[model samples]
Target: MSLGAKVAAGETRFTVRSPHAAAVDVCLFDGTAETRLPMTRDGNDWTLAVPGDLSGTHYGYRASGDWAPERGRWFDPAKLLVDPYAIELDRRFAYDPRLSEYGADTADLVPRAVVQGALPVVPPAPPRFARGGLIYELNVRAFTMLHPDIPAAQRGTVAALAHPSVIAHLQKLHVSAVELMPITAWIDERHLPPLGLTNAWGYNPVAPMALDPRLCPGGVAELRETVAALHAAGIGVLLDLVLNHTGESDVHGPVLSLRGLDNAAYAHEPNGALINDTGCGNTLNFGHPAVRALALETLRHFVRHCGVDGFRFDLAPVLARGPGFDPAAPFFAELAADPRLADRVLIAEPWDIGPGGYQLGQFPANWLEWNDRFRDDVRRFWRGDVGVGLLATRLAGSADLFGPDCRSVNFLAAHDGFTLADCVAYEHRHNHANGEDNRDGHGENFSWNHGCEGPSHDPRVNAARAEDLRAMLGTLFASTGTVMLTAGDEFGRTQHGNNNAYCQDNAAFWLDWAGRDTALEDHVAALSAARAARRAEFAQFPQGGEWLAPSGAAMTVADWEDPASDGFDYHVGGARHFRIRRAERSAAI
Candidate 1:
């Protein structure tokens, strides 16, 4: 039987895989009335079929069995369990510990799943982007929260992206693809409400398939319409999905969906404690066939129902961590063989906090990886600590780390770190507002404050910072692989030195639409155009490139060893060449 509630042949059927449940019931709601129907079990799956169409019906699951936290068997019948494959949700999940307690009933506070019709099928279209294209990553909410031109009602929703102002800005940036942060439904951290904070980055997901009602009030149809609008404008959409873990934190966390249905779906130790590989309470159990099937089902849902162009997997290494990291994992092979995801893009974060987790360049050939090496090395070069030789390697595509067939996704800063402007103005992380006593965020940012911390009014200081920003942008564009720019980095967006602004969703994380450096914005646009044209030219002439001295001779080892060496040329065969040079504390493209 297929998972989730599906309608077919004038009847509605509810099927769920509960491997260890002794009893399962489907709780159907009609207005204020509630009806509980017993489910028939065969092996591990439970099935319940009704005689009429349940198109507008809402329902949930109740699995009853032994409750042994230490043994990892959490079966709370009082708690209404959500279907892992629910396409539509009636309300957001409200957190209450009683829902997970062994004998407490919290039906009124739980969220209900709505039965949806089959997804509409559309003719397949060619991908709008390929490797070596620029990707602009932005959160759907923060990107338009303060936009002056967007309508008041649609300001921070998915529909805002289709506005003329938003589309025009993306067009001007010349970005080939737009990577949106997670739009799926998520829960706040267990301790957040008490501390007066909320999950803004959407990394703590609870439901992988249902759209967050707050972000998309218009539901899945709105998302489909938005995708169509972007495709019409020649832009592709990539969603940042969280499949490695769920919002169900440690054993003390709420019993929302997965845990109540089957605790075995999560990774566990020999003692049956949850595995903390993802640093997020529970790591998914890819070792189980049913867990892997759920992941595949979610991927196909987004591609076939929502029509997204690609996916950026968060904490991706967890998917292949079968005892240890394996390149030929079952899920990877399953994805490669699936015809539904043939032309869709697939990118990975490439690392986690678990042992043997940093598997950079170890993914399958079809996947692109986030190059932390490129990000750190480039930052160090611009900070004046590293020399041009290191920059040369990164600019040429970090061949030391990646195979020739795998493309690198280079970036300087992303949502988790300080903004581009903050990178040059803050040497220390100022995360006092995050309520962790300044103990949160990364300690080693490889940043420089240029003789001052935070903001400054000195003309010489401002001028120096401005020039360094341009040089770094120029270097990124001149590099040979795909590049990604944060939402407001082009015009010097700042977060006041908060490196980890994931919890600071206010002005610190939102983009300032009105206050932009027009000059810097124009410079970014020009660099993007140059990169596209240069990439095309390099494809035709793949060889005959070498390092050259500033004096027009082949560079020697002694030249590279010189501490004061500020510039060198990457001379292509024939008369073509590219240069990154610094003179008098200012670099030029």
Candidate 2:
């Protein structure tokens, strides 16, 4: 811990917490070649005396110790292991069982070597994030794929996010934080690739700390630069963290990172079998102390090294669930108390596939959740279903869901489901592209085809769909609670009939840089204009507001259920809509 012992000009001192490894070598690489230097063990630490390795040197770890799989140690001297703190990766991981510990289970494959910054990692981010902050959800690839101004080399990577075009786009949108889909290193489901598809959105996480090579431009600095640019624009970046489960497929899944490092720590399956909660193959058990430590360390590492402003937990409720998905689990409470994460902008997906798993308003006040009810209601109303009264309840922040203080994150669409355009153009999910035979997406989209399915030449139908788009997005941005608009929603991008294109690599999911509709663009502009006008007049976050329902409609759960009886109905879709009134009581933001 002292600088008295100086390192050579290119030589660096290194340490690891593996006393059991008979020998540890620092495998150094200078972009092209690699050299191995041995490390000596002293007590619990292994110290490496490298021969002057430069900053950009690519490197990995080589440990000579136990190689037993059953006992949980898979150290192989032949394999060049990647450092957990790697800042850069050379390539995206291909979904091969060779990447896994077993043949196909992802819970077994470890990460590849990457270059990290030479400076020491910083401490945790300040525990400070404003409540009622507007969150913008986006997928890294989709957000910039069609951007004309973004450089082709940087497009779709973390570097693309920092481009002026991206920054300008977000500023225009006016959302405070950007909730990015899982950026951590992950692998697409094997079925998709053979079907000629790529995992467009990274939901299946392999290594929580490793950056997905596909999205990395240079290294951690690529992320740092992107975050810095966003901060300069007064925007925060909230990573959609995947902790509930891993990319590791079912019992026949691959063996990647954690499965190789310590499967017992990361894998949460009871009796070493998969739990279907995450809908992913395996889950991370909160019961293990090491798992908790590693998870916490991973979070701390991200905040320190990556400059992430906040984390949107993919399956936050799973973190709180006990042995049997109990609500008051220690993990949630622990994260709430951890100084590292307490004041962070914690958002949750709020539900998993587990039994009794949907806890909409159950999370504590510190956390905001993806309000599925809001999406359903708004979609129902826009799609012109009957009984559309509940639209106001959702637009009013779902007091039914959020209660006295907690606010729900309401949205019309997100990365996981149907896009706003698809919500109207397509009636049912077209997930045949995902190789699940159309069974991958939800059947109940709550979307209407407006008297016609798919695209139409009838200007009336087009006009109707356009109106529906405005109504939904307008309501989302103009509502109470923290609003989260998906990346492509603003431009009214459509995924054709592919509602659930989780694994479509082709042009089907990519943003069409050339085919933008001007009318829809104006609609998006109007939505932003409304939000900005209101936001400028009323203080953001925590200051009160009264959405004085414009039509002078009073909202209640009863009225929302039956639209014809009241003015509107969110469930069956109706005619009447409600508005709000802002209370600008506080001057201080």
User: Which 10 successive residues of model 2 have the least lDDT summed?
Assistant: 580-589
List clashing residue pairs in candidate 1: none
What tens-digit string does per-residue lDDT give for candidate 1 at 478-545? 77778899899999999999998877778656888889888999989888877776666422223568
Window of ten residues with lowest summed lDDT in model 1: 535-544
Full-model lDDT for every candidate? 0.83, 0.65
Candidate 2 scores a C-alpha RMSD against the true structure in Å of 6.3
**Top candidate by lDDT:** 1
Residue lDDT tens for model 2, 107-129: 12334454343544545655323
lDDT computed for candidate 1? 0.83
Each prediction's number of clashing residue pairs: 0, 47
